[model samples]
Target: MRLSRSFLPTLKENPAEAQITSHRLMLRAGLIRQTAAGIYAWLPAGLRVLRNIADIVREEQDAVGAQELLMPTLQSAELWKRSGRYDAYGPEMLRIRDRHERDMLYGPTNEEMITDLFGQIIKSYKELPQVLYHIQWKFRDEVRPRFGVMRGREFYMKDAYSFDLDHDSSVDTYRRMMLAYLRTFQRLGVRAIPMRADTGPIGGELSHEFLILAPTGESGVFFDSALEEQDWLGEDVDIHDRGSLEKFFTGMTSFYAATDEMHDAEAWAKVPAERQREGRGIEVGHIFNFGRKYTESMDITVSGPDGAPLYPEMGSYGIGVSRLVAAIIEASHDEGGIIWPETVAPFRAVIINLKSGDSTCDALCEKLYAAAPEHFLYDDRAERAGAKFADADLMGHPWQLIVGPRGAKEGKVEIKNRRTGERTEATPEDALALVMKTQG
Candidate 1:
């Protein structure tokens, strides 16, 4: 993608309304624009980043046997009424009325609707263990929505529902999701610690919130430093094996971690002072073992082996697909701008034409552009070198390939690491090879 041809509307000054780093940078970098109080229109650059994140999430979900199925944004209020949660859900639920005067709503979550769907078709235990997920927009109508997408009233989320015939199997499903969540976040270059959390309106004794520590985060968290050192990608996870999943669970849960809602002073005090780390955290993923909460309420029953009606045990896992962009920026950005992880960056490397319109520099950029992947954004616009450099830094691709008359004359291109700020000069072919190796 050529910058001159792209719709990247970067700003020179921070927007006053943006209170957080992610919010401010997202606006300044032209990734998103606020259409309303908490609703945003994802611009081209931002949409690319969102797609990258969503693809990673889908890959991880598929790897764990979860099937994708999108549910409607607008739902019949009758579904919530069936579960006796119509009034209980409070103002966060965006209630509405259709022309026929029927009660309707933009779904904040899909428990009631999914339970209704499961009850309608899944009658036998043959389909006992199934995981259904969707990546879709959700509306919560938050009273004081702020902090950009972090607490947006309208945002994208990846929500999955798991159904099992028995309690034992349901717990296994929960564990599988936990492992998958850890793997997903790890692959995105973020280390999220799973901490015991209050289930809130979701109603579950067993719940975990995957938190990424950041100063501007919403949740206060305390945990063992060991969590930072553990890597989920290092292990071979077998989701079908209950025993193996249990071991993985134990290994991860051995470290003490808790959100403020579930914090226990006595348990925290027992940890050695050196191992304790208390800080603010951003919640990126949440999983709950809600048992029969939804199934029982909605009468989603399956026939047992003994021919008795049984309410399927259930759980739900959620990842804030849109909020992750803010969380990532909060954790990774420096003074310049966002330092995007290669996995979620809109472009793997941005080729900045330092001396655009100059014959040698323009020719070198053309060569690099031809060799680069579709994801690479070539800045061939007629902008000053400093402006191009600043824009490249603000956009935060993992690598920056710069071309200039001097470097082109020497048959060399400069490749700079966005995260480490290390600059190296190499032949164009060598630069391409280095970028491919690093991006992969």
Candidate 2:
């Protein structure tokens, strides 16, 4: 991906409309562009990051045995009517009418539709447990859609619905989702703590919101530092084993964690003084255990083992896939620009040709880029060295492979880690080896 051939439209100055750090950086770095109020078009680089995040999400969901299936962006209004929330849901629901005048909607969430669909497919306890998920675009008519993708009216989301025949099994499904969310965030290269939260329009008594710490977050957060020490990917819990999931859930929830709306001074005091952590946090994902709310309201039923009709318990889990792009920037950027976690970085490293037209520098850069053209963005534009350095830092590739004439002439390249600002001069082969190892 050569810069001369790329569509990167980076800005030298911040846009006035961007109020938050993520919003400003996203615009200045040319990752996204506003097409309408609270709506955006993701550019090539932005889409790359979006896809990377979704892939990690998909992998974790698959690991937990959740089946992947895409659902429609447009849903029937009748689905919501059956659940008695069509009108009660208020203006945020983007109500519309087809040419024939049928009531329709761009889905804000998929509970009603998923319930109706699930009821039709599984008719007996023999199909007791099913967890289905989809990643799709959704729209909500936000009265004031602000803060870029962080609070966009239209955005990409990953929503999963789980159904179980019994309360005990349904709770276990909820625990499994909790485990999945923790591992998902951990792999995305951020510390996201699960805090008990309001179910809101989703309507669930049991819910948890995962918030990643950031100074620009909308909510105040308090938790025990111990939550920061665990490595979820390294966790030993077996998703298929009920006792294993139960133990994992208990161990995780044992640490006190809460958003300001649910904060308890009594519980906060109980945490060791050294363990108390207070900061602002941005929500990236949420999970709910609503039991029979949707199933009962939609009158979805299956035969029980005793041969009587039964309503399957249901839960919903959601991650703001697009919003995460912004949330991650909020949590991980510095004065220069975004410092991406390697797992979600659009490109693992960028090849900077300090002297673009210079024979030696161009040759060295081409050599580095050719090794993994798909994973590296090559700055081959005829530009000044200072401008090249600024753009590379602003774009925030995890590493910068510098090819100046001085380094290239000696058959050496300079590699700089964006996060640590560490630079080392090495043979081109050695530099590639180090980066490839880090990437692995």
Candidate 3:
């Protein structure tokens, strides 16, 4: 995409309302704009990153045999009433009314609706093990929506539901999701520790919240320091292998990890002094093994092998997709701006025309754009070199290729890695080759 044609409203100064690094950088980079309190309109650049993150999430979900389907943002309140949570959900539920006075709501979560949908179609144990997921917008009426998208009242999320006929099989499904979640966050370049957490309004005895440690985070967490060194991406995970999945789950949970609500002083004291890590963390994803909570309430029953009616065991997994955008910034950015993981960067690399109108520099940039295999944001706008440099850094592409008269005359361009601040002069072909390899 050409900068001259992009809808990038780069800001000169930080927005006062944005107190967090992610919020400030997001505003300065023109990735998003506040449409209302806690609601945002994702601009072109931000949308690209959002789509990239969604794609990665979809791929990981698919890897675990979870089928994809989109659910509606608005749901009838009758479904929640059936699950007995309509009244229990409290003010966070954005209750609405249609013109005919029927109770409606912008969905905060989809447990009730999904249960109703599953109950109508599934009747036998043959379809017992199934996972269905959707990526969509959700709204919660947060009385105090703050911290930009981190704690937004409205956000995007990927929620998956798993149904199984027996407790043993349900545990298998939960383990698969736990492994998938670990891989998902690892690929996004965030170290998320799975901490036992309160089920809250979701209501489940077995729950885990995958948290990424950041000083500006809202949740206080305690864990073993070994989690920081353990590598989740070291091996390929086979989600269908029950034993392997179980082993991974057991291994990961063997460490001492819990949020403040679940913390035990006795357990904390048991850990060797050097292994303890207490810090603030952001909850990026959560998973729950609710067993038959919704299924029993909503009459989602399947026929057992013995021909008896039985409620299907169930689990729900959620990843706060929009909140991850903020979480990533909080964990990775430096003083300059965001340093995006290559997997989620809006663009792989940028082509900066240092001398915008200069014939040689312009020709070099245009040639690079025309020849490159991947999309490169060609900065052909009438902006100063310093401004272009700053914008490139704030935009957080993996690489920046700078073209100037001096470099063009010497048949070289300045190639920079955004994350490491590494710059080197290279021939045009060499620059493209480096980018191609890194992108691959």
Candidate 4:
């Protein structure tokens, strides 16, 4: 994408309202703009990054046998009432009334609605195990919505619901989801530790919140340092194998990890002094095994093997798709700007035309841009070299290819790694080859 044609409204100075690094960097980098207190309008650059993150999330969910289906942002109040939560859910629920005086609401979560839908189509044990997920916008009336998307009132989320016939099957489904979450966070370039957490309004006896450690995080976490060394993606665990899933889950949970609410002094003392890890962490995802909470309340039932009526056990898994944009920034950014992970980066590399009008530089940049247009963002504007460099760094493309007149004339360009700040001088052909190799 050409900078001249792009709608990036980057600011030179930080906005006073942004209190965190991700919030301040997001504004200065022109990724998002606040339309209301906690609502934001994602711009072109921001939308690209958001879509990339969502795609990765979708792919990971699919890998775990979860099917994708979008749900509406607005839901009938009757659904919540059926689950006995309409009154229990407090002010955060955005209650409304239609012209007909019927109650309605912008859903904060979809447990009740999903249960109603599943009950409608599934009436027998034939569909005993199923996972359905949707990526959509959700709203919560936060009394104090701040820190940009981190605690936004309106944001995008991916919520998945799993239905099984009994407790054993439901536990298996929950274990599979835990594995999926670990892999998803690993691919997003963040080490998210799974810690036992309170279900809060979701009302589940079993729950886990995946947290990414950051100094600006809201909750205090205590975990074993060994949790950081586990390579979830590298582990060989077949999602469809029950024993494999159970073993993997047991292995992962063996580490001492818990949020402040669930912290146990006796357990903490058991860990080696050097292996004790404690810090502030931000929640990026959560999973819950609510069992028959909704099914029992809403009178949802399916036929059992013995032909008896049975309430299906259920579990819900959630990943903060929009909040991840800010979380990634918080976990990865430096003094310059966000250092995006390649998997979720808007573009793999950016090409800077140091001398826009210079025939040599223009020719070199155009050649590189055409080589992989989808993977590169071409800076063709007639801007100073310093400004171009600053903006490139701020956007945090994994690599920056510099084509100055002198280097272009010599048939050489400079390639700089955004994370390491390492520069290499090579011919345009050599640079392209290097960048393409990294793309793999």
lDDT of 1 by residue, 244-273 (tens): 898888888988999888899999999999
Query: Candidate 1's error at 95, in angstroms?
Result: 0.6
lDDT of 1: 0.91
Candidate 2 achieves a global lDDT of 0.92
Q: What C-alpha lDDT, on a 0 to 100 scale, does residue 330 get in candidate 3?
A: 96
Ranking by lDDT: 2, 4, 1, 3
Clashing pairs in 4: none
lDDT of each: 0.91, 0.92, 0.90, 0.92
Off by over 4 Å in 3: 233-237
Residue pairs in candidate 3 whose N, alpha carbon or C atoms collide under 3 angstroms: none
TM-score of each model, paired residue for residue: 0.98, 0.98, 0.97, 0.98
Residue 292 CA error for candidate 4 (Å)? Answer: 0.3
lDDT of 2 by residue, 334-391 (tens): 8999999999998989899888778888888889999999899999888898888899
By summed lDDT, which 10 consecutive residues of candidate 2 come out lowest? 230-239
**Residue-level lDDT tens digits of model 3 in 1-440:** 89998898889799999999999999999999999999999998899888888988999999989999888999999999988999999998989999999999999999988888888888899877989999999999899898889999999999999999888899999988988898899888888999988888888788999999999988889999988778754465567778777777888888899988899999889989999999999999999999899998887788989889999989999999999999999999987788999888888899999888888988888889997635688999898889999989888889999998999999899999999999999999999988878662
Task: List residue ranges in candidate 2 displaced over 4 A.
Answer: none
* Candidate 4, 1-440: lDDT as tens digits: 88888888778888999999999999999999999999999998889889988988999899989999988999999999988899999999999999999999999999988888998999899887989999999999999999999999999999999999889999999999998898888788888999998988887799999999999999899999988876655457988889998888888899999989899999999999999999999999999998889999999999989899999999999999999999999999898889998888888899999989888889999999999998899999988989999999999899999999889889999999999999999988889998888652
lDDT of 4 at 241: 86
lDDT value, residue 86 of candidate 4: 97
